[model samples]
Target: MKSVLLLSVLSAAAVSAQPKLTLKVHTGKGQTGYDVNSTMIAGEKDMLVIDPQFTLSEAHKLAAEILESKKNLALIYVTHPHPDHLFGLAVLHQAFPMAKIVALPATVNAAKTGWPARQKFWFPTYGNNIPGPDPVLPEELTEPYLTFEGERFPVTGPLQGADGPGNSFVSIPSLKAVVTGDIVFDHVYFGVPKDAARENWEKTIDQIAALHPAIVVPGHQGPGATDDMSAVTFMKRYIEDWDKNAAASHSAAEMKAKVLAQYPNLGMEYTLNDRVAAYFPPAAKGN
Candidate 1:
């Protein structure tokens, strides 16, 4: 009996000594840039950041949070190439120069090639709020997963997302949590651009649901969005509604009206207008 008790105590001590992973989320509220989420996965002595912010001010705030955590910033993972998700790389890189910033190869390529146009399009409105002329891109990640303190955070995708292709998510299997890029949106209008494939996006969401993640951190969220399966459910339902409404409506205006009626309280109505307009442009003059 004494031997058994000694072994049990030893096992408890071993479990207690193991470093546990915790998550800290920094969400950019609506006025700042659509409430993009930046998640920090912290271990005992080190942490990994997923998806930096859109504006410089927000990024600086995120950096301050990281500093206060008292954990070494070891790795930074960008889930996609979108400006809102990765434009803050410069701020983070400056703050933690020794940390490695990485993303899937396709994402790296897209950011490299798309930076010039993205800058031009957003600069006029965002002005100096965004990153400067010299963009800081992430390195290509060759490995299938990210590692910190002996644990693996699996990287999935280049999967079909609302923003089109070259999107990815990082999954923490032990925690049953996923840091989804624009693949998921909480209480915001989905970015269904002209090139976006609704069917493919639905399938991708289905795949994510299959993982049974307890915590679902969306790339964009609203004021009081929670990190859970609700985002996944919301995206799936929203897409279904979009498909149904789009098919019945004759014009983008009609479609937008129908969707709004369904989700009147949803934020980012501009995104809905922009996407529908791309789908149904005005008739050529004098035709």
Candidate 2:
């Protein structure tokens, strides 16, 4: 009996010794190929959690770290409108009711309505392009309270090619970090700028670049961003490549196949709802 009690005490101590920020990152599970982090903002008692991990349990797990460490849950911020990025919102809210949800006004509006349009476009046309119903926020929050209007490129929408709401950015003044969501998919999605933004992709990047946050919190990676800010250049390069290939690959299937063949890792970007095989074609035609 005494041995069991001693073991319990040791386990409690081990849990107690782990840092709160470290605990926020559950390396064991709930990661959908993304590294989640809840930063230690300078002035806020409650943390400025970025992305909030990948699952309901993961959100619960993040909340558990706060509750255990006695930290206030100030707000949960989503960089953009992507499933793997924001699936934890409902769970986080369940744990931290008072915590406000923050995002660019456009992100909120787009997430509320834009994703569904993409769903409609892709489902019947392609059948298995994406995996789930368009992601909807908890019905309780109607209007986005916080707004970030990037002056570098103002958001005027034709929403041309991509169904994403609009490229938008926000500043966590306390953290000095700009939450850059799907607008910036690191170096990986750089080749497919149109895949993310149809209308104002460039403008959004300019806005974000103008702020030049000391640190940037992208949707799927860790902090300390030294590169990948050359999104505009990379995107332009991608468009040039696409145009060069357009003479031969005109159909959507051809475009899809070429994209997959060129970047095999991109086929790895699918969520549970996305189609793995379709994303990667039998071969890059004219091989």
Candidate 3:
């Protein structure tokens, strides 16, 4: 009996001493107007993926990375309902049939409503570059933590951020990392919806900064932009600058010129004009 007790203790100790998980961040192409991000969280026996990506081609590439990991995909978490974030779910479903996809109830509703409109809008620009506007809506997360095999890993939020309402982020306590869906952008143009709530988004940025994560994985950015907290800083600065410029500028052209001057290297210039128009419509007939 003593020998058996000793062996049990030894086994438990071995399990406790195992190394913690390390996360991997994958960035899709920037030219798509939505530089989507996908994060993989690995454990000893399985892995979890966050926010697959935009196009079918991108999802295929993301799946290939997971397959190469040789770890069972335990679950997939869709952070938000934006078409770029949720539209590639069909591809992931084909790749990881066994993995359960989870999201907040709000995200599901938003995805359903936005899917059709986005399909029409993107078709002309993306052509056949994207897969089904048909997204695999996620099963609502019934519990506070995600379970892999029998072990539990805690995930926080339906946390709203930069992309507005229904945006969420995933925090892996073990990895000291947070996968921030559109709450943050690194040197990328933030989508300014026609009815953007600037104050709410700024508040969300504060909430994210409060989390004090050692590493931040933004929803849209290039590869070099991941694994750093600078995205948070840049996003805050961008919003502040935008608000300032929008208030002072007379037209979309003026706002665009001022913003581009401030952030010369920021990509998605085409969208910048749209954002300006959203906030400050063209001055009517040279008033």
TM-score for each prediction?
0.86, 0.53, 0.83
lDDT digits (tens) for residues 71-166 of candidate 1: 999999999999989888889999999999999999999999989899888889788888776779999999989988898888989898777777
Over 4 Å off, model 3: 1-18, 149-159, 192-196, 223-226, 282-287
For all predictions, the C-alpha RMSD in Å is 4.8, 13.0, 6.8
> Poorest 10 consecutive residues of model 3 by lDDT?
191-200
lDDT of 3 by residue, 79-158 (tens): 88887788778788888899899887778777778777888888888887666556578888887677764556555566
Better of 1 and 2 by TM-score: 1
Q: Tens digits of per-residue lDDT for model 2 on 42-129?
A: 2224555556554455556666766776767665666555544555676677678887776555556656776676556545633442
Which wins on lDDT, candidate 2 or candidate 3?
3
Steric overlap count per candidate: 0, 2, 1
Query: Which candidate, 1 or 3, has the higher lDDT?
Result: 1
User: Candidate 2: minimum summed lDDT over ten consecutive residues — where?
Assistant: 149-158
Q: Give the CA lDDT, 0 to 100, for residue 107 in model 3.
A: 80
